[model samples]
Target chain A: MRNSIITILKKELKRVFLDRKLAFAVFIMPGLTIAIIYSLMGGMIEKLDDDAHEHITVVQTINMPHDFRLAAEALYGTGMIIEENEPTEKDKAVQKVISGDSDVLLVFDENFIGDNREGLPGVTRYANSIKDFSIRGGYMADSVLESMRKNILSERLGGVDEATVFTINREDVAKTEEKAGKAISMLLPMLLTVFLFAGAMQVGMDTIAGEKERGTIATMLLTPVKRSHIAIGKMLSLAIVSLASCLSSLAGVLISLPFSNTMFGGGFNFSDLAYGVSDFLLLIVQMVAMALSFVSIICLISALAKNIKEAGGYIAPAYMVILVMSMSTMFMQPEGVWSYMLPIYGNILSIKNILMFKYTHTSGLISLASTILFASVLAWLMVRAFYSERIMKSS
Target chain B: MIEVKNISKTFKLSKKQRTLDGTKNKFKIAVENITFKAKPGEIYGLLGPNGAGKTTVLRCIATLIKPDKGSIIVDGSSVLEDSREVRSKLCLLTNELKVDPNFTAEYLFGFFGRLYGMNDSEILKRKKILFEEFGIDEFADVKTSDMSSGMKQKLSIAISLVHDPKVIIFDEPTNGLDVITARAVTDYLKKLRGEGKTVIISTHIMTVAEKLCDRIGLIIEGGIAAEGTLNELLEKTGAADLDDAFFSIYKKTRENVS
Candidate 1:
């Protein structure tokens, strides 16, 4: 039986890899698509990072008191530059914020010093309509006001050498850096899912559907081998091809990493985010399970289709489902109970968690088990379909 | 040897929606009470028109489909009980010859040989002999995509015989071949008969049937209309040729039924 299966697999692989067109479809195009996707994503991330660090010209109106101006100068050091403009009214400051002439405008009210005494600093920051930068500006303004209040309290305490009354020692939390690194880490799993899905469809659909279209399936069926053997062999061949494509895509992503710092404008490297031995092993298991799931699903679909055209039709909805599941990881962190129970959902979520250095054993195990279960059921369905009269008589 | 006894098959056709509203499906009998026998070293011809159940009967013998109501025993193994063994003992060459366009003739030939349980050396030996005999050695390494229809047909025939089974079945093998290729195929079938292999061929061409088949069975609709040796059928129908005899049997059966 092993020999028979191996023979079938050899023939299947030969039929796929030996043809120039299929070879290109199965190997080259998928890797190229992966490179293109990661390249685009890396470009977007770089653009965002560049926007975060770009020089910002902050114009302060004359109503801004000496204390607020001093705080603004201190806060804008290195990260952002605040260029004080000539005296301007409130409406002029708002116009500068909207017209992109300045990153922000610090407007102080006429009774600013009196308001500080009354415990309402009354400061307004004007910035462009961009959300992230605007939020960052708001946080900066709040910090400056808090510092000024602490200084006023020190002066009111009679200057008896107040022991650093508002000693705010801000430690480097590293969360933002970790978040960016985690984004880079998620690249593999996302690419893995896409590549495996595409590879399975490319190889499996072409294996069965192409044969049916070309009228070669009936000839293979007429051989002395059992239909079940043929089905298993073909599915196994597709699984191997999918695994190869996945590996190729991973290689493509890894190869593009050195250029990522330039592409993403931050010092992010995939090698820097590498996991330990145990974690790496778990990832391998996840990938194997993912490849099996993908291959089995595509094999089942291919069996139902009569030809490549019909197979192409069937795979469109499959692609949509996978695409939605993969993109969901980007917008939402995998947390809810339902997220752990779904098959591909769990797989992508686990990868997200792993990338963020939050490892959960239960989630990984459940995802792997679900993938295996789904693969078993689909493989069984595909085997049964090989015995079906429609497949046998389709030619 | 091959034995088929009282094999019947039925196909259900859903009723047309208009006049047959709410009606259940009706069955069309494709093969009914068909019985035949072929011993070693004989050629049995199943002669029928387009939908006269010849291919269906052959399919049952090949174990590609099951008979609704009968058994086929090939080389002492029942098709239902030991289909794998029956498959091993026979080769069914259908008219639809589709080879993987990516593989060379040599690759396909060797692949099928391995599937038949032949070892590498044995496959290599048979590959050379078959390639030489069939004049396929020149295109041995050429991809099947570039081969002509006649060449593909020949390659298919060679691939079918790689394991050298005791019984061979052909369903309209010469349907699309040119005259020269068709003659070559017929001569090859005769050659298989000479080697003491039981050959069953299904065809509507009277000349090929009359020249090649030792015994002929005329199938009409879903059952055998007549069966005998060529001379026997000619005498029974009082016809000058096999074609005339075939029409005579068909007309008599139609008239009797109507």
Candidate 2:
């Protein structure tokens, strides 16, 4: 049995890898292309950030309050250029912002600063939301006005310090770690699962359905080997291929990290990622299980189809369903053991837990065991399809 | 020796196939109660037109499919009970046996040879002979996609013969080949018969049947309309040749059915 499977695996891998064009298209190009594209996107983001600082235009700031002036000066210390323009009519100031010539238009009321204020002091900010720089400038102006309001409130409250009302200290290491972990969990599992499925679908359809379409499957089936051996051999090869492709895609995502960090203003330090070897080993194990399950799904669908086109039609819906399932994890509450019993959903939750460093041994084992069971069932169905005369002859 | 007894097969036609057939009947009787025998050292030909159940019978004999209500025995092994044993004893070829576009002939030959449990040296030995016999040695290393159709056909024939099975079966062996390549295949069939291997083929080519088959079976409408040697069929139908003999048998069978 082992010999038969090895023989079949050798043949399939040879056909896939020896063809230079197919090897490049399926295995190499996806990762390399994605890495290059994301890197370029990161570069564009960095350029936009640099250009945003020069775009702070503050109109009609001659009567700005003392507290607002102090806040605006602090912004200048941080390298923001808050240019005070000539006092213009309200309509013209708004028009300049609308035309993208300026980032913000601030109009203060005539009784803006007074000893006895009758009406509530008001400031109107006109900024185009469609422009990122204008939006940033608008947010900065709002912060300055908020600081002035806080100062007025302190004076009204008999010299109580404004900062004493609410002191937000976010220097706790555990809390910060949890926040980072939550963010990573919300996004990475969905991305990883989608990438693994995409990688599997790219090659798995051709493994069986393509052979059936070309009539070469008959040649393989006529051999004296058992049908189960053929199914196992094909599924194993597909899993390995898909896992490698997913890793390549992951490498693409990782290679673009530094640029993305600078672009998004996260300033995450790569050296601060304190995951140990065991953590990665666990992640690798989960990824392999996830990949096997995905490959089994693709192979079963491919086996049921009469040709590659039919397999493609079947695969599109499966991809959409898996994508939706993976996306559901972003909002899914960490439920009890029952949630780990679902198929794709369970695998995804397990991956999320592992990445966030919040997985329990019981939940992890159940999820992994469930995934392996599901994969085994799918593999069995594929073997049954292999033995079916109707499926083989229709091809 | 190959013995097929009361072999019958029925296919449930899909909606599309039924529409093409212009009938509401959901079943198509491909082969019904068809039986024949082929002895060693003889070339037996099944002569029939398209959709005459010839390929179905061949598939049944090769154990690629089982009959609906019958049994087949090849080399004293039951096809239903011991298909694996049957597969080891015979090789089946049809136009549907396509070459993988990526691999070369040499690669496929070695691959199938190993599956049949032959070691590297034995596979190389058989490959050398078969390639030489089919005149495929010159282009054996070329990828199948780059080869011409005739060359691919030759390569397929060589690959099928790689295991040196005792029985060989083919459906429409020369359907799409140039005369030269077709002749090479027919010549190899004769050689296999000379080496005391039982060979069965299905074709509608009268000249091929009359020239090559020691015995011929005329199949019509999923049944064997007549079975005998060329001279016996010719005499029984009082026709000039096998073509006229086939027409006479076809007309008699159709009239009786109606």
Candidate 3:
């Protein structure tokens, strides 16, 4: 059985990797696509971070309170090179925010300082756009007003401690570097799912459908080998190719780890993220199961299709369904029994859970087993189709 | 040796129009109770027109398709019970000549040799013999897509016979070949027969059938109209040659229908 599968795998690999165009699709193009995507993402993130930290021109209107001005200078002094401009009216300031001349505008009401003992009326914050800086300015303005109110209360209480009057404690909830590494790890399963599905479909569809289209399959059918052997051989070959594609894509993803950390602000240690021996074995099993399921589905479609064009038409919907399922793992938590029972959905969800360090061994194993079972049934259907008189007669 | 016994096949076409619902369409009989045998060292020809089921019969004998009725036996092994065993004993040369453009002739030869369960050394030995025999030794390393149709056809035939199956089935072997290539193919088939292998060939060309087939089966409308030696068929139809004899049998059948 091992020998037969190896033979089939060799043939499949030859079919995919040896064909210059197919080789490009399987190996080179995918890596290039990953690199391009990562670069674009990294560039966008850098641009956004730069915009957040860069200096901005502010036109203060309505005579900002002394305390508010001091607060603004202190906040903007860190990285923002704030430039003061002539005071503009509130409506004009709003208009200026739209014209892109100023990155932010702060307006204080005329009786703002006089009402320092009490809460002040609303302060209008504006910008050419509602950008991150403008939002940060609003927060800064609110903090300044709150500090003035606390001072006024302390004065009224004759030097009593401000802690009894009011207090606010802020705790940082941002993920640490280790937790951030874990967060990025959540994408591993999704990447694996997408690559495996894509590889299997690409290779499997070509194996059966392309052969049929080229008229080589009919000649092959004339061989004395059992139809089952051919089906197994082709499936095994597709699985190997699919696995290689998945591994290559993984490598591409890993290569961009530093960029991913820089873009997303994480300190992910590559060594920490490496799979152990047992985990690696489990990953292989899961990937094989996924690859087999995909190959089985494609082979069945190929058997049903009259030619490669027809096979492609059939495969489009299958791809859409699997794509949607893979993406769904991103939005939902895989805790329910249903998520562990569906084929591609279950497998992807289980893999996602595993990558996130969620204890989902049972679910993952079940998903793997069910996918293999489904693939087996589909493989049988393909074998039966091969044995059918109609297919041979049509040929 | 290969035996096809009383095999029949029918295909049902689904109605295309909704308005024709509930109306029963006739089932098309591709092969009806057709039977023949090929002994070792003999070339058996199945002569027929288009849609006469010659290829279908050959496919059945190759065990590519299961017959709706009856059975086929290759070297005393049942096609249904032991298809793999039967397959190991035969090689099928189909009409369509397609080769993977990526693989060189030598690679494909080695690949198919291994597929037939030939060991590494055996495959290498067979590859050498086939490349030399087909005079494609120089071009063995050239990609198949770069080869001409004649070269591709030669490679296809060589690949089929690489394992030296006892039974060889060739369906319209010279369908698209030029005169020289066609002559080369027919000469090769003659050589195969001479080497004590059972050869079953399906063709419409009467001259090629007459020159090559030791015995011929004339198939019409999915059934064998007659089967005999060249002289026997000529004498039976009271005609001078195979073509005249074929026309006489066809004319008699058409007249009987009228």
Clashes of each: 1, 0, 1
**Candidate that scores best on lDDT:** 2
Ranking by DockQ: 2, 1, 3
Candidate 2 stretches with Cα past 4 Å from truth are: A60-67, A77-88, A115-117, A154-166, A175-186, A262-265
Error of 2 at B34 (Å): 0.5
Arranged by lDDT, best first: 2, 1, 3
Off by over 4 Å in 3: A17-21, A57-60, A78-90, A104-110, A115-120, A126-178, A262-277, A391-395, B14-26
Consecutive 10-residue window with the lowest summed lDDT within model 2 chain B: B62-71
Candidate 2 local lDDT, A65-87, one digit each (tens): 55676767665555444545445
- Clashing pairs in model 1, backbone N/Cα/C closer than 3 A: A46-A264
Candidate fnat values, all: 0.64, 0.65, 0.58
In model 1 chain A, which range of ten residues has the least summed lDDT?
A261-270
Q: Comparing 1 and 2 by DockQ, which wins?
A: 2
Interface RMSD of each: 1.4, 1.0, 2.0
Per-prediction TM-score: 0.85, 0.94, 0.87
- Per-residue CA lDDT of model 3 for A174-232, tens digit only, reads 44543644576556677787888787777677788777778777666666566778778
DockQ of each: 0.58, 0.77, 0.53
lDDT of 1 by residue, B1-258 (tens): 989899999876555632364546477788899998987888999998988999999989988888888899999999888888888899988767588888899889988888788899988888887787778998988889899988898898889888888999999968999998888889888999999999999999999899999999898988988998999999999999999999999999999889
Best model number under TM-score: 2
